[model samples]
Target: MPVAVVLPGALNPLAGCVPPFDRCGARARHATGPWASSQGTQILENGDAVDLTWVESAGAPVIVKEESLRNLWGGYVNSDYENACEVDGYAGLVTFGEPTATVTGLVINEIPAPTAFMEEYRSIVQWISSSSDARFVEMVREGIASVSMWDEGPIVRVNGPLAIFDAALPGTEAGADELLLVEIESDTPAPARESIGWIP
Candidate 1:
């Protein structure tokens, strides 16, 4: 009917310009994983929400939760910390500050190449010699961040939680004292899935 109807308030087209699902409140909760662990989500808020996976070790202060917005709101250039950090599981953006590596690719122990082929086949030879138990996570490295496990020294404690073989690490330069190769081991068992988007 065209009869006059009361409205709660004048419908301002500008009102709710931000989509409900896209709108993020200042409040943030742990998206997933244990408190302050490597394999968890740390959500941040601006107009858009950034789902930052805690790529480093456990127990590191949830710094990004607070600091991420400052760069956007404060009208300052994004520091290297923000630039080097990986977002949305893409690689090639690992930095020394966070050192938490996240890759949106398949992580597996080994790739058993075709073994049924001829003995002289390159594929068969590569498959037979590859260690079935060898484990590694592959991701893109931006700028100078490289991952190598061959230069062995200590078990590479990334950001301090994920202990990859030393071969999987790039050497940190000297005088970078904060880049300590910790021998600490986390008792927390690995999760079945690579990522958890909910935190309680």
Candidate 2:
């Protein structure tokens, strides 16, 4: 049985209360089908249906209904969200924080939506931009808080429009393993796309 370690989220200290994935059984890790038809529950062998949200699968598909989509950001869904479905792979994320040594590129693996990549990048910018560089360093030391049950991946590297990462590229496959989400940060307010190269 695989063991899972749930981390505490930034705002929630009790975030790791969920049972480990091994205890939930294999079904919890490899869920199938759509969420809506399941009555929001995962039934165990004894016929007990648990709440779907608490399942904590790393890679699942979530079909947000039209009504729910309406309430998302600006009362409108991101154009990129039109066909989004993958469950958030980085839901209980452990952010690696900005690199101590400058790097040319970054890779944020296994995210659910294009908007999320942008949102996270924006958050890092908002945090670092509003404070002094010393404060940014302090925040890094305080470390990123995360839900204990999620995957750990690279933190936001920089704040670039999705285009720099070629997210909106036509004919690109959605949820493809190769479609990595990346960002670029720079000393300049608006850095050129070439400032940071995306390895993926």
lDDT of 1 by residue, 29-103 (tens): 122222223222223222322222222211111111111111221100223323322222211222233336322
Q: Residues 31-140, candidate 2, lDDT per residue (tens digit)?
A: 23232233234444445333321111233211211111112211011333222322132222111112462222221222211111112223211111212223332343
Which candidate should be chosen as best, given TM-score against the real structure?
Answer: 2
Reference-based TM-score of each model: 0.17, 0.19
Query: Which TM-score value belongs to model 2?
Result: 0.19
CA displacement after TM-score superposition, residue 134 of candidate 2 (Å) = 4.4
Local accuracy by lDDT, each model: 0.18, 0.24
